[model samples]
Target: MSTSDAVTTQSPALSSEDRSARIAVTVFPLLILAAFAIAMITPDTFKPLAPGVNWALGVIMFGMGLTLTLPDFGLIVKRPLPVLVGVVAQYLIMPLVGWALCYVFGLPDAVAVGVILVGCAPGGTASNVISYLAKADVALSVTMTSISTLLAPLMTPLLTAWLVGNRMPVDGAAMDILLMVLAPVLGGFIVRFVAGKFVEKILPLLPWISVFGICYVLLVVVSGSVNKILTSGALIIAVVICHNLLGYLFG
Candidate 1:
């Protein structure tokens, strides 16, 4: 092909939605780090927000829902192999690696259980933004994230119980998971399905909303464990990094 023709056929500029996703992926982690630092320094300030952690999570999940369209889920049917592979790998690998790491480090009971919980949990909403930024299959990313999140109440509790029951009590509340994760997601989907074009107009804003919600969640989580974070923050951070890198590598 001629140079001019090749240039002309190059992909168009990123849509505003994709641009927003990239921006979110870049900014959200910085925001979380900031929140974590602030909470460690001023635990009391964020302790009051602890009660609302579930609420903040719900908001984030809802924003995730708002970005979804029925067609996104259709990717599951159209491209079943990749989708199933991603989903199964996500649910299985992360948790197993997390459980293994707990023993490797001989982690304290509380920290060990916490790591397992993190592993048992599904993919976060931010994965969609990261996938978009990485030029990965955004639709497959969303579907995997959504499916795994929907399965959390069942899978997380079961996995945690099996992996950590002897070390710590596992009282998984299905209701809490339903309220925090499922309800808002379903509500967002319903709104998008019902509002159609109107929801499209606000799609660019959803990432920011999710970012805010996640930062708030960090604040609450850190505030509740300020002393633990302050005393073992470095160790926790190391374990978390190892866990995350291993999950990605395995996945």
Candidate 2:
């Protein structure tokens, strides 16, 4: 082939990667925009969809379970101490930090509970990816996040009740929530155990599934926020930003 033709052929290949990178960059912001647009366009319509948050959470957990195996559990059994430390850190650090922010910033009751709820919640599945990107201990991170998440039904409600229950009236029946969350996860794990090769083949798409799930949850939350935003406006934004930034700093 002529040199010019060779370069021309390669140019298309290079542009494909560039296009993918651009899409990846824009996808999240676009999702955020769509979420806000939905919130504005049909706020009441999305209210009924709120229950889907729990379902989406379950699906995300199941995806996490699908990525696991017997060996992952064995790794936890083999090295209990570090895993224990990470789990403890995950539970205590985030909630306490959130509580302190509530007091320090003087957040009102409802917003304060929201902050505590997110904090009391277990480390997200995304933390494993973050740990990997940071070149930290991926296995340990996964183990800690998994164990903490598995325990979230009990721990999350309990901690939230104890800390912010008075403010927001937290229901202490965490076993119910736990069942809802873990059933899909355990089911996924069972599927992985029975069909390892099949699970492996589809594992590559799990992250995208998770991204979609997160976008759904964000939509629900933002939709809920529309009324509050309309009433409170920038003050709500300031409070939420403060809560999120503080949670990240302390988390």
Candidate 3:
């Protein structure tokens, strides 16, 4: 192949959607850092927003749903291997790693329990958007997230009990998870079905909506824990970051 042809094929000019996703991905880390600072500095501000965080998450998931098409799900059947691998790895790796971290850090019982819970929990709602921004397989990400989440009610309780010696009341949170996460996503898909063209027109904007919503979630949740964060936040933050890096490396 010719050099220019090779270059053209290898690095084509980004489409408007690609550009937007790129920009959002670039800004995402800075936004989260800023949100963390704001949350820590004025924790009281986010206290009021706590009640509505689930709604905010639903809105974000709805946006994620809007960006999808029926064909996006074809991969689940056509290529199931990746989905299976992702789900299995997610369930197996993160929980054990969290337990190991808690032990290594000598974390308090409450903090250790929290980490274990997070480990056993399915991927966050923001994962789809993050996956999109990273140019990863969104369909695979969505499917894995859904599968892991559906499995959580059983897996979480068992894993938490084994690791932390305290069983999580998954029965209670199970309904909330469905209503808050899956329901909104389903609603979004329905809307997309009814108005495919309109949804396509607005697809480019979904990443920004997701980014803003997730950042707000971070601030609110972090703000609520400002006291604990301030008291021994450094250790927690360090361990969390280390845990994340390890997950990335292994997963």
Name the best candidate (by TM-score). Answer: 3
Per-residue lDDT for 114-209 in model 2, tens only? 778887887664565334333355456666766786787678878888888553344554555556445766788899999999887776566556
User: 1 or 2: which has the higher lDDT?
Assistant: 1
lDDT to native, each model: 0.78, 0.70, 0.85
Pairing residues by index, what is the TM-score of model 2? Answer: 0.68
Q: lDDT tens digits, residues 1-251, model 3?
A: 99998887885788777888889999999999999989988999889999889988999889877766789897578989988999988888999999999999999988888888888888868778798777677777878888888887888889889988865565678667767767888889899999998887887898898899999899899988888888998998898998899899999
Candidate 2, which segments miss by more than 4 Å at Cα?
A: 1-26, 124-146, 149-173
Per-candidate TM-scores read 0.81, 0.68, 0.92
Tens digits of per-residue lDDT, candidate 1, 1-251, equal: 99999999999998887798788878877998899889888889988877788777777777766766788777667878887787788778988999999888889998998899888877765675456445466567766776776777677878888898853343555446556655776788899899979989988787778778778877888889877767998889889999989987987
Model 3 TM-score, all chains together: 0.92
**Cα error, candidate 1, residue 33 (Å):** 1.8
Point to the candidate with the largest lDDT. Answer: 3
Worst 10 residues of 1 by lDDT: 166-175
Which residue pairs overlap in candidate 3's backbone? none
